[model samples]
Target: MDQLTPVVPDDNKQAYAVTEVTPEDAGDVQVDVHTHLRDGVQRKMEQRHIQMIALAGTLGTGLFLSSGKTIAHGGPAGSVLSYILTGSIAYCMLTCVGEMAVYAPISGGYIHYIERWLHPAIGFAVGWQVCIQYCLFLPSEIIAANILISFWDQAFPKARQAGYMLILMAFAALINYFGVRWFGESEFVFALIKIALVVGLIIGGIVLDLGGGPNHDRIGFRYWKDPGAFAPYHEDSGFGYFLGFFTNLLQAAGSFAGIESIAFTAAEVKNPRVALSKAIRRLFWRIAIFYVVLVFVVGLLVPYNDPNLLQSTGTAASSPFVIAFNRAGVKVLPSIINAAILTSAFSAGSSLMYSVSRMLYGLALRGFAPRFVAKTTKQGLPVVALSIVACFFGLSFMSLGDGASTVLNWLSNLNALLVLYSPSVGFKLTHVSIGYITWMMIGVTYLRFKKGIEAQGIDRTAWRYYNRFQPWPAYWVIFWSSIVLIFSGWEVFTKGHWSAQDFVIDYITIPIFLVLAGGFWIVKRPRWLKAHELDMFGNIPKDEDVECDEPAPKTWFGKVINFLFT
Candidate 1:
């Protein structure tokens, strides 16, 4: 009867009214039946689970084997300082990611955040970047494991390396196949074992330095003094040394690649809002105390100039743990530590497989990848995704042949860029303050909130959450990110004459991702640009009410103040 009323059919059938929807209302519409709505997905991971997963993912071959390379590049002083610097960057980025994860706790982690805050193109770019990084990492860890196992040269022949690698891969696959809980539990036990070993090593190193063992030299600062406070690799001027420090910084950062696993597990964690924050805070301190302090201690205990340190590079025997044990006159301990190194490598490789598969699954869910990858097993395992990832493990076998050296070098180069670039984009996309891409989303969010408040005639007092520090984080993020971006490009151009291979390695991946992202944008511009599908935060239907809506003003001044605040 009225303009708003729907007309009934002749047979008295009910008729549905077609309502006019605003663009804002359009985005709020849900399509995926399984998409998380209120509270957004169930949180099942506990604090211990998160910690152990992070520990398992992070405490890997990097500590045991890679420190030698870092020391070799930057000298002990430079290496230690570089690690500290990288740790600081990691801390900042983790904090930024923590803020977002605490709020949304999406299964896709930063990728989803990237999509929400930035463009779908950016998210697609980073998703692939992470996927590729983790895939590359799988092979690197496997190769490291193989090398570590070779410590018992006679017991474990080089010929059996491939076979053993396969077995290990199969074992890791089985563990991961069972589901997240089983994977978390396995990582928990492995992480505990790794942590215990590290503590023992630290205590043993301390005791050895105190003259408790046979080599009774009271190591103290002797190594530090002999190495002249730091290992100076560059023969050039002060700037050369400074540049070398950054080289080590990049390497150290690469070593800590998996540290962000804490954020990735946020979606599955129990009480992620609280647990993720705590884990992030703890991760900062843990990395500082364990990695930075331990590396400092190692550098002091074992002189950077030691022949053993030089020889350990690119070999299982190159691990500082073995060298430290040998220096301390612990003949059997080196063997024990070598075994631990192998286990750590296996753990790292296993974790890589798990992470990459999940990332692929996330990509598929977002339509950046094929839909088949989104399909999961009854246990929620993305079986197709896992299989696709498992195929990359075969790349590890390349290390078994004579081309191993070339493969290692290329992998290293590719890995270095992969590690640096993803975080650069991630920091860029997250609207975090650490990188050049500032929180454009904050401005967008604020404007949207203001409009919603105006539309709903809500008062400012009703606002629940507010950010005191605005634009500063965004400013720093943009400033620093720009610096790093420029630095990366400059480094390539200046050093291009040194090695064309290095130039290609450093610069190629970033552009490839950019092009891919651009292509995706061009193809899906319509859907991607849709306000409702913009991937802002979690796509919560009530975001306007929660984030933007305000209470009614009590007076004109109150309304004016609310307008000013908006």
Candidate 2:
């Protein structure tokens, strides 16, 4: 039997068209007219688009709104430390993803990688796990949007707020319905606005710290000294300080939530090998400048013990930045920052729509979902998959009943937990969070990929994109992430602090993943591929056939803009 199965065309489905294979390739493979990409999607997402979409998805409410919570928990110095550590882990994991993505540029990203390197059942499970993650994630963005919008007026009516959310939902659907290029372009603009906001906030933070605000109160690390670097948690002891730091570390994981999504856009991005490499290299800087530096500024701006920091106003009033500004007698900037936060939330929701639909399309392509889900429009938009995912936006309306902040916490907790549990090790061992699981999966998958290359004698030097640092980053992720996961829920197990909700939130994805992967394994009993048997070439796009139509900018201004994005 041919290793590659032909895609059976449906007259009602305009997603894929059949293509004739060359004489040499005829018996061994089947080809599609859209073999350059997948599910009839076009390679229109430029390098800038890929970079900015990741930025748009990641730099949302976590930094603008929730970083205050981090400061309240971990104090100034402790929060900075926590963010730095999480940033390192994110950097290492992204490099592992980049190495694989640049090589194959597959549509499904890590899900497909897990299937090819390990077992199809594992991929099936992880794919749906992430798909479900985004389903929950979409509503959280809207919930956050409501919080930011309410900053303008504390008396904002709830019914009107819900209506506003629906409008944002409709906006996201329209952009995605148009096509990936439209989604990419929209994200590019949104990301730039977010980038400008962070940069401006950072510079303004320095000015405020140096007594440049109207109040002329030089804060120059006064909060750090007053709070004494680390805030105590539960009890005033070394153990308490440790718990504070750990709590901040977990929250930092939430801030870095969508970092790995760049891999998911691999197939649709123009010049996947080159574009992904550039974006991956820049990923570290993005984390460093936006998250780490901005978080450091946050600590300087507000004291850990400030009463306003804990006030869940569901508005910029609770943001450390706005709180700092209010104290410094600068009133107008809070409104401006609130506006940026609102846009950030909207941008995040729109990006989630694009990501979730693409994931569903990928699932259908791999036969993990119904084939009809893969159907696309003439323009290559995955209309069917998108429509199904769009229904999930209605879940945002849950905010109307529970209150925006309450629903936001529930969704945020689930998403933050998911970061630890991205994908796990063969469903064997126990005790980990969503973020830890994500790191472990990427590490383990990369390790398996390396082993396969060695066992199969595949030459690494010939690959278009290669990371010289091999198994060490993978090892670093596995060892540290395991340690974090094991101790992540320690607070709950401590004296008089056990909460069922906390415990469940920390470890819930384990059972959920087990049910999904194990159920599939029991039913299908999919064969695990041996290293030598891994079909590395069959799914890879032919470099010669991939058209690099994106032209270099000629004008000096265009060149500068291109350089900045790249």
Candidate 1 local lDDT, 346-445, one digit each (tens): 7777777777787777677667778777776544567888899988888878876754455565566556555332221001111111112222222233
lDDT of each: 0.59, 0.75
Model 1: residues with Cα > 4 Å off, grouped in runs: 1-44, 155-159, 312-316, 401-406, 410-485, 488-497, 526-566
Best TM-score among the predictions, by candidate number: 2
Please state the error at residue 251 of candidate 1 in Å. Answer: 1.5
Off by over 4 Å in 2: 4-38, 236-238, 409-433, 547-549, 554-557
RMSD of 2: 4.8
